[model samples]
Target: MTLLHMSINAHDPQRVSEFLARILGGEALPFPPFPDCWIAFAGSDDGTAIEVYPLTHQLVAGVDQVECRVGGERAEPTFAHIALATPMPADEVITRAGDEGWPARTCNRGPFQCVEIWIEDRLLIEVLDPKMRADYRAGMTVRNWRAMFGMNTQ
Candidate 1:
C-alpha cells in the first residue's frame, strides 16, 4: 500500500502549503472542502499531497460526516512526522527551509539520513533527497527493522 495524502495543522496554512509545494516541486492550491485550507500537490504519479489546515481548526466526528471547527487552542510540538521523497538536493532543501525562517538540519537517522524541517517551529517534516531516499529504501525494510531490535526475522 502507498500513502496518498496527509493532513497537518499549520500556523499559516497558505504559507506552509506554498513552502511544501516548493519542496515537492509542485504547486499549492486552495482546498475547496474547507475555507482557508490549502493543499500542496507533489505532482507525482501517485498524486501525493499534503493538506494544510489552520492551527485553530479541529476535525470533529459527526453522525455521518467530519466537521471542521475553529476552536482548538495552540498546540505544542507533536511527535508525528512524515518522510517525503524529493527530487531536490539536500543542500537546497536545507537552504529553502532556512530561507523561510524554519530550523532545518541534516540528521543521521541510523538506517538513513534526512533533513528535519520544523514547520512554524511546531511541526516536523522529514525530507529525503535522492541520495537519502536511496539509503532509506535500502535500510528501511521489515527484515532490517526486526533485526535491529534483535527480533527473529522469520
Candidate 2:
C-alpha cells in the first residue's frame, strides 16, 4: 500500500492541529486507540495522507520524542521536519514560516525545488516542482518537494 501520513505526538494537539490545518491543509482527526491526539491531511480523494500525533500524555515520564520525515522518508525527525507545498515560492514559504516562529530555508535541488523549515526544533520541509505542486494543489498529485540532501545537494 502507499505510504500514509507522518505521526507526531504533542502535548497541545489542538493548537498544533490548528497550525498544521492552516499551513499544511491538515484537519484534526479522532484519536481514541492511542493515548495521544491526532491530525491528518490526505492530499486528495486518491492519495497519501499526512498524520500528526500529539502526545497529550507520554507513555512514560521523561519520554519526549517526535517523529521525523527527511527527503520524503520517515524516521525519528530529531528536527521538526514538516512537508510543504510547491508553487508557493520558496521565499514566501520561508517568510511565512519564520513569521509563525517556524524557520524555513529554500534551494533549487536539481529538478526539484525545496524548502526546509526549523520550528521549535530543526524542521526540514520543502516546496517543490512548480508545475507538480500546482497540480497537486488541484488534487492531481502530491505537491511537496522530494527533499534531497547530500554532497551533491542539501
Candidate 3:
C-alpha cells in the first residue's frame, strides 16, 4: 500500500506548509475545500505530502483542543515527531534549516546520522538519510542515541 500523506496541527498552517515545502523539495498548495489549510508535497510525483491544518481553523474547532507547544514534557497520545527520508546530505539540510532560523541539530549515532529540525520551534521533523535508515532497520536503539545525541533520558 502506498502512503499518501499525513496531517499535522499547526498554529500557522501557511507558514509551516511553506517551510516543509522548501526543506523537503516540494510546494505548498491550498486545499480548496477548506480555507487556511494546505497540502505540502514533499514530492508531487511520489504523492507524499503533509496535510497542514490551522490549529484554530473552523474545521479544527470542537473536534479537540489545539495549542502550540515547545519541547518539554509531552503527554500521552501526543505526536512526538515526523520522520521523512531525504537524499540530501544531513549536514547541508541541517545548515539550511539553521540558516532559516529553525533550530536544527545533527544526530549521529555510530555510523548512523540524521538531522532533526523543529519548524517554528513547535514541530519536530527528522530528516533521515537512506544509509541511516538502513542501519536502523538492521537494529539500532536509543542506547546508541544517548552517546551521540547527549540525550537526557537517564
Candidate 4:
C-alpha cells in the first residue's frame, strides 16, 4: 500500500504549507474541511499531500469519525516525522528551508541520504531529492531492512 497524505501541526500553517508546496513542486491551498488549516498538494499522480494545522490543534475521535479540535499542546522536537520525496534539487531544498529560518542539514542514513528540515525548530521533515529518492528506493527494501535488524528474511 502507498501513503497518500499525512497531517502535521505547524505554528504557521500557511507558511509551512507554502514551503512544503515549493519542496513538492505543487501548490498550497486552504483545507476546506478544517478552518485555519492549509494543505500542500504534491500534484503527483498518487495525490500526495500534507495537511498543515495549527500547533494547538489535535485530532480526536468524534461521533462517527475523527475530528480536529483545539486545546492540544506540543513539546519541541517531536519524534514523529515524515520522509518526503521531492523533485527539487537537494541544494535548493536546503536553501529554501534555510530561507524559512529553519535549520536544515544533509543526513546520511546508511542506505540513503536526506535533508532534515526542522520546522519551527520543532517538527522534522526529511526531504529526498531525485537522486536521494532513487537511493532510498534502492536501499529501502524488506530484505535489506531485515538484514540490518538481524531479523529472519523468511
**Global lDDT of each candidate:** 0.70, 0.44, 0.58, 0.70
lDDT of 2 by residue, 1-154 (tens): 1232344555576566657655656444444334445455543523234444543332211122223222322334332234445446667777888899875565443333456555554444545436535443444222222121111212
Clashing pairs in 3: none
Q: Each prediction's TM-score against the native?
A: 0.53, 0.32, 0.39, 0.53
Number of clashes recorded per candidate:
0, 15, 0, 0
Relative to the true structure, candidate 3 has a C-alpha RMSD (angstroms) of 14.8
TM-score of candidate 3 on Cα atoms, chains taken together:
0.39
Between prediction 3 and prediction 4, the one with superior TM-score is: 4
* Segments of candidate 2 deviating more than 4 angstroms: 1-82, 129-154
Candidate 4 least-lDDT 10 residues? 59-68
Superior candidate under TM-score, 1 versus 2: 1
**Mind giving the per-residue lDDT tens digits that candidate 4 earns over 1-154?**
2343567888899999999988988777776556788878774523466779887775543343334566546644442457788889999999999999987888776678888787786666778888887777666544554465565555
Off by over 4 Å in 1: 1-75
User: After superposing candidate 3, which stretches have Cα over 4 Å from the reference?
Assistant: 1-78, 108-112, 140-154
